[model samples]
Target chain A: MAATYELIYWPGAPGRGEHIRLALEEAGASYSDTARLDAQKCADIVWAQMSDNNLGDKNTSPPYAPPILKDGDLLISQTPNILMYLGQRLGLVPSTPEENDIYKINALVLTALDGLSNEVHDCHHPIAKELYYEEQKTEALRRSKEFIKTRLPKFLAYFEKVLKGEASGNGPWLYGGTFTYADLVLFQICLFQPQTDSQNLASSVYRKRDGVREKS
Target chain B: MAATYELIYWPGAPGRGEHIRLALEEAGASYSDTARLDAQKCADIVWAQMSDNNLGDKNTSPPYAPPILKDGDLLISQTPNILMYLGQRLGLVPSTPEENDIYKINALVLTALDGLSNEVHDCHHPIAKELYYEEQKTEALRRSKEFIKTRLPKFLAYFEKVLKGEASGNGPWLYGGTFTYADLVLFQICLFQPQTDSQNLASSVYRKRDGVREKS
Candidate 1:
């Protein structure tokens, strides 16, 4: 079957785009990644799509950032929002309306990405994204220490407790007694941590591939 | 009807909770503000709910942070996720699947809050959220300037263009020719801006309550 989805994100970096890629991978969904095709052209396309006078067909609303997913005529951005839509279409969520489970799973996905992903990004760019990492190293070190000591432990412990809850049915999944998009999201975030750190994660959840923890 | 919705957050500050409050107010929805009732008690409740062994009915998963909404058995956190769920329940979104309009509107809301509210909060705590503002004043000043110069203008202009797009129908509404949650979210974020800065926003969308611009 032909890929029905097109993802446009920064080239050579598994930053925000990793979360979406993991969801696609878990779903085994066919998709084209523009960044991996031609980095320069992908960057050009991303910039064009973000502009007020984008080069595409004029009616589509401009995407405000990269890591955009194009499905037929729809263009969606924001990591969690994209994941929410894809989780439904890809059967990565509970296929029932019981207990408002979609919202529950979505809330978990949002919290995981916010703390593990967004805050980590901020640690590297504490002063400004416009500034280089070297320029913000002092602030980055401080922020990172606080994040690991305080926020990281809290988030990890919360998810650990969640996994043990009845919602998971004592399974490794985060919800519905089955693997869902929330698991894929958490798995992807764990991949970003160092091997030792990921190994030390509360739930012993990180998977090993070929003697090295695989990214994405 | 009595307010069945319970909102828990830090007191004496608008912060992200204001976005939820604005959505409720705009929909004329009845909801309890626990933080506003007794700030200390509310803080205690929030902390308890966030703990690994939270003193709650054990089935519900712990919220990773505050600004949680408890409606019956469901407890949700993450400002945008909470707002997204409420937007649908309160009829604050375009009530249709046409054109993937809901996702489009939600993407805009996420972008607005991420750049404006999230980044703005980071400006004062560039080094660490645990640190005092005085400790990070120099870094905060630097980040704030970049935010004011680059991020603020970019976010404002993008939303202004979104308002003018075909989805908006050349009106203040952001999607499907109706006042939706996206508008309420944007309006609330604008309220957080300084009076002069909010007035100078690219779009003439912010309104005055009681014939005066109300600062959140």
Candidate 2:
């Protein structure tokens, strides 16, 4: 029997998990999502499967975290890897080596989105998640400021270059000719709320000043 | 004229860049590494090529960071993408879909290495690099402890399953028979000081704990 595609992710926070959801939704693949309230519940399920100690089962890989995709006996995790798997499976990626190069470029941009997410998460919990955000407000402010000024522009510009460099010369989308998982992640990251008014202003100002902009 | 592979990375920090270097070395591909003493020197060279106003050669796509690989006319970034690209080119990845599925599994493990690197960096600078580690000592300690106790085991256990689950019954390596880039990254991550210490204890403890465990 063919295994069904089951996706396990956090139900509440739409963070990294959205990447997997978007890919599956776009592919129109049949899959189930197990979103628990907390990490404990998620970890419990993962630990239980890993405890099985059976090496032969095709789908029994232990997931390190949520946003794992299970196909019958095959368990796979990692957002980029899941996207790449589905991209190829669903024909979202390109066929030729040259075309696949573009797919890779798009994939790379999506990884940058992960970096951006890390920065965003760090803002609220600059010191550590173990410590409350309130306790690290001052440090968070500085970190958020640096992220807005330096990191955000660098990432956005790279995507803009990708957009401009597309051989197809189309409007919007990273690959230009096709809509890949990269575009979805780009849209998601660009839409995330900035930590402060000034951070938001900085981003907008740079976009406008540079004359290469995306509408939020 | 063919464009030679030119890799630009910080000379001292064999951090993320080492992954690319190792893949290229393993493939025996001809390449050059342009490293700098400090971030300032590195930025100068990167920005010089990146300056939009210059636009000397429109054919070249500028990469946003180091470990960028230029093959012929193509310039690629992001470590895993580069590895995947090389995997296909060097015949390290399997040609068939079933084989590709295994390749994807290995790629996900490499991506996890990237995640682990970020956590390691965070341990040293938990409160943002803008603040000195001296200021965030308490937070760093807490995060580092959590990483050692929780994250390391989860990642290692996943890889162990991948190794054990190999259909060919391979020894040590994650995939069937050969050492993919995934193995290189895994080996690198395992060598990290903290992980090395914990891994020793894990092997001893889990050896005893394995028999009693049950499936989820």
Candidate 3:
């Protein structure tokens, strides 16, 4: 029997886990989405499997957080890592060396999306998650502004180059002629900005500067 | 003519950039390490070229940050992205579907390293980089403790599975036999922790862990 894929991620917010869901959805793969496993249940599993004292005769793999994928006996974690694993299985990645590099680039784009998510989380919790976003609103605003002015443009321009580069051939997608995981992630980034008040800031920069278009 | 790999990173601290450097060194590739490019130099060449306003007609890929790899017409960024690119080129990665998944797993390990680095940076500037470490010392202490107790084991156990799992039999390296960029990154992570204060805390929780012996 073929290995079944089990995706474990938080229930709501469609955050990082959404990227994996998008890929699986696009591929029409037969997978189980266990949305929002009880936080305590998840924490208990993590502690039982990952605790230092429990290291005897156990499976050894370091998964920092969820959005992990289990295919038969193979359990993998990390967002881009999981995506890359799925990209290959789903034919989302290319075949040849040159084409494979494009897939690698797409994975990097997804990794950047992860970085952006971290930044967003930080915006509301600049001090610490231990404290409420209300406690850090002033600091969050300052940091958010810097992120808008500096970081957002830096990341956006990077993708624009991928879109316009020779590899893309003036194509709409970041890779070859077809859309890949990179496109999914780019779409997600654009979708997420509005929730964080970064949409307006990005639009102003992208608009004032002609030649770049929002496709998806 | 072969294109020399040009790497741009901050001058002194290895930080994120070191992972790229280690891969290049292990591959025995000829490359230039350009560091300490201040705001002016960054503007004159790095930032200007990467910016949309200055991209002009150049067909090169844009890099989001330092440790970018410039190979002929191709310019790649993000540490794990660069390593994945180099891993294939240098034959550090295997050439089978299963092996390729292992390579992807190795890249994921690097991603974990990146996350750990972020946490370490937060230890000093927990609230925000805008504030001094002294201001957020209390919060940093709490966050750092959580990281040591919970995060370290979670990450290490994942690696232990990859190491012990019968992907290629219980072997030394991450992908079984070969020493890929992942191993280099794993080594770097171990080295970096001591430089920061994380070593002392992580040791108590993760010192006797399995599969960690290979890393040692």
TM-score, every prediction: 0.89, 0.74, 0.72
- Model 1 per-residue lDDT at A78: 84
Give one digit per residue, the lDDT tens place, for model 2 in B20-93: 77677767777777663477777576666566543223333455555667676666666777777776776655
TM-score of chain B of each: 0.87, 0.74, 0.74
Clash pairs (backbone) in predicted model 2: A48-B216, A58-A73, A59-A73, A59-A74
Candidate 3 local lDDT, A172-194, one digit each (tens)? 65565456666666666565344
- The model with the greatest DockQ is 1
The alpha-carbon deviation from the true structure for residue A1 of candidate 1, after best TM-score superposition, in angstroms, is 6.6
Model 3 / residue B16 / CA error / Å: 2.2
Candidate 2 overall lDDT versus native: 0.59
Model 3, position A211, has a per-residue lDDT of: 21
Model 1 agreement with the true structure over B1-216: per-residue lDDT tens digits: 767898888888888888898888877888999767777887887778776676233445667788899887788878888888898889888766475666777887888888878888888888777779998898899889888877778777787677667766665566667777777777767765565654466744544221123432
In model 1 chain B, which range of ten residues has the least summed lDDT? B207-216
lDDT of each: 0.75, 0.59, 0.60
* Higher-ranked by lDDT: 1 or 3: 1
Give the range of the ten consecutive residues with the poorest summed lDDT in model 3 chain A. Answer: A207-216
Candidate ranking (TM-score, best to worst): 1, 2, 3
Q: Write the per-residue lDDT of candidate 1 for residues A56-122, one digit (tens) a residue.
A: 3334566788889989777888888899899999998877646567778888898888877888888
